[model samples]
Target: MSLRDMNCTFSPAALDAPDVASLLAELDGWAISGARLERRFALRDYHETIAFVNALAWMTHQQDHHPDLLVTYNSCTVSYCTHSAGGSLTNNDFICAAKADALYAQRAGA
Candidate 1:
């Protein structure tokens, strides 16, 4: 399914009990860091890494929310947090994380 693009103003509720495990599994490597989801991406080079960050920036802009992005010569680390919610996770974090995963998969053809 496509990543949710609607502005998710919903608060973080305990996901349906049964779905929690599956969702956690999908986000295994990308774990909860601080108030959001965190993931690291390793690219082929600086150019590819920058390209990836640019794409992510565009997505973030479209969503009207931003993430904490750390870009290096060949790696990019992303952390999604909703400041208004204090130090807590939210659906927006997961939505953005899933979108990033989709983008990575599309770029890697995997």
Candidate 2:
């Protein structure tokens, strides 16, 4: 199954550098900066940005995995790392990253 199709369960292990790099390739507009998987979505305006944030919030809430979001007037920067795994990047990060990409695609119609 695709990452987005999979659910995030409790995992205490962090992904290794090679695994993280491989998974990062499967995600669009996402990059690895330190231990976090990061992406920035550019929206038309504040309204769209907030809408995207709220939608993403709900999705993450359902998965029980929250991301650090930097919101602005026209963009939202999302960063994900597993605090439960000692702030390292885990499989949950990539799974949620794929879901976030799907959300952005549907919301932005891109």
Candidate 3:
């Protein structure tokens, strides 16, 4: 599935291992760990890190999907999994992962 041009909501459905593998290929900086999609990003500073988190919060809200975020002084680790899908990988996870990547790119360009 191509997620680059996607703009949609997260409808939860469990993905099989093969399907998850195919989708993960198209997502940069993201990997499947256990049942979740995970990505780690290093930002410029504490301020930038928080800014990134805030931006991500807004984006996830708009998509109606959320990820587990771990924030440090200059780093963020985002983990996505759908509880509705019995804690498995879903399109929502990849969709939000793609959106998070876009937000990071925009921040980097600025």
**1 or 3, greater by lDDT:** 3
Clashing pairs in 2: none
User: Which residue ranges in model 1 land beyond 4 Å of their true spot?
Assistant: 1-7, 10-22, 108-110
- In model 1, pairs of residues that clash are none
Q: How well does candidate 1 match the true structure in TM-score terms?
A: 0.76
As for TM-score, the candidate ahead, 1 or 3, is: 3
Cα lDDT of model 3 by residue, 46-68, tens digit: 99999999999998888777889
Candidate 2, RMSD to the unseen true structure: 1.1
Model 1 C-alpha lDDT per residue in residues 1-110, reported as the tens digit of each score: 53444355545553443453455466646876544578998888888888888888888887766789999998899988676667455667767878787677677433
All candidates in order of lDDT, best leading: 2, 3, 1
lDDT winner:
2
Which window of ten consecutive residues has the lowest lDDT sum in model 3?
Answer: 1-10
Model 2 per-residue lDDT tens digits across residues 32-101: 8887899999999999999999999999999999999999999999999999999999989999999998
Model 1 poorest 10 in a row by lDDT: 12-21
Clashes of 3: 0
